[model samples]
Target: MHFVTGGSFHGKAKWVQEHYSASRVAEGWFNGYEDASWETRDFTTSLVVLEGLEQLVKKVVEENVIGGRAALRGKLKLWLDWEASEPDRRLVLIGTDIGKGIVPLEKENRLWRDVTGWFYQDVVMAAERADVIWYGLPQALK
Candidate 1:
């Protein structure tokens, strides 16, 4: 899995395409996916692009799941594991760095920032190649 993240509008998708040239790319957020059924789907030899991953986490945290950090981390791990199960498929997770800059006043927003940043760190550490994009340029961090 290749994890790529940056602030919004930083051209992460462009970088992914230019580098991987993956034929099948599927973007999430409007993905209509749920944990119960996600593992059954096929992702073999494909490139799955999940844009705005923070939003997905936020949604999950709000709706069904509970137990805070550990639960959230485990849920995310399951999702990522499903993506990685098909070894030939490359999962390109495009997320925004919401933990930077001024923090938000709203409690949920603050939590989102914290959790997203935390999860990103964990994900990056596990990824074979991790990148951060700035001004449409990619910096390979791992």
Candidate 2:
């Protein structure tokens, strides 16, 4: 699994697509300033937490299963329950507009930026590898 994240209009998704040809990508946008009603920070954090949990479940299931007919019934129930709880299993996550920058005027906006930046950091820590793209150049941060 690969997680690509960057600031606004940084082309994180494009880089991932170019390298991996990801068949599926899940995007989470925390529009902090635009919508006042939504808890964008909390939502983004939940999404990242869910992503890590789902990945762990996948690894567990993959490890338990072996081969043909027996594999189907071996750990199917355990895996099924886990899968049902979290259904969005994305192979790749392209998170855009998440970065650290100037402070916002509103509390929610400030919270959103801080949370998004933290979320990105958490993702990078959990990921096997992470890359930062700047000026059309890729640098491995982890």
Candidate 3:
């Protein structure tokens, strides 16, 4: 269970793919006050989202006291339920356009930045034991 995220074109996914070749990355949903979707949400939202996921994971691990395939399945169901309830949790979010500094707008642009930022925060939390990749440079950020 790893979450890879970063600003647009930051190569987060590529890095993950390179490492976890067999891992599956899925897209999630968004629930924000603004119409720009991910653009306006704040970092706190990302933190909450990640915290929710961690809680869910803990629940799964606890339920899987027996430690078997059945328990794993049950834990997976827990994750599915969480995703159904919170679409945002289902996403492998990425921000591909934030190198030029903040955009000059108050609607979609801002929303995108905020959302991307928050998403990245969540990814960091979820993938706490993550490795940061920049310009082909990889660094551990746990």
Candidate 4:
């Protein structure tokens, strides 16, 4: 599994596409920005890209998932298992760096940021490769 993160509109999707242009021929991309329903997505392709992680986290916060991080971790574990089930399969997670900038004025927004930050940390720790993009440039973190 590979994790890619960066600020909003920082070219994260572009970088991931170029980085995996070869394997992307048969990739499945779940654009969470438009719809954060990845929990119900079924993957048939070897390369699965989950973009707009921040929005998904926001959804989680809005829904008030019980156990919060623990529950999210369990959900992530399911994807990890899916990736491990297929030797040739790849899972790429693209999240915006919402932890930066000024703190949110609203409590819900703050919770979203906090949970997203923690989620990113967990993914980075578990991912085989981690990268952070800045101004369309990528820097390897793992």
Best by lDDT: 4
lDDT of 3 at 82: 46
Candidate 3 lDDT over residue span 1-142, tens digit each = 3454334446655665455442322222332211223322333221222212222323333444334334434433444344456545433332233434757575544544444444345545644255555665556766
- Residue by residue across 1-142, what tens digits does model 1's lDDT show? 6788888778876777677664323343123233323323554445666656676667655654455557656755765787667766666776777777998998877877777777787778777888999889989998
Residue 51 Cα positional deviation in candidate 1, in Å, after optimal superposition? 1.6
lDDT (CA) per prediction = 0.67, 0.43, 0.40, 0.87
Off by over 4 Å in 3: 6-10, 23-100
For candidate 4, write residues 17-68 as lDDT tens digits: 8888833334498888888997667898888999898888888778875567
Which model is ahead, 1 or 4, in terms of TM-score? 4
Q: TM-scores for all candidates?
A: 0.76, 0.49, 0.40, 0.94
Give candidate 2's whole-model lDDT.
0.43
RMSD of 1: 4.0
Residue lDDT tens for model 2, 1-142:
3455556566664566567543223334322233322221333221321222222322333444323223323323333333346656323444554345567887645544554454455556555566766655667766
Using TM-score, give the best candidate's number: 4
Per-residue lDDT value at 25 in model 2: 38
Q: Who is ahead in TM-score, 1 or 3? A: 1
RMSD of 4: 1.9
Residue pairs with backbone atoms closer than 3 Å in model 1 (clashes):
none
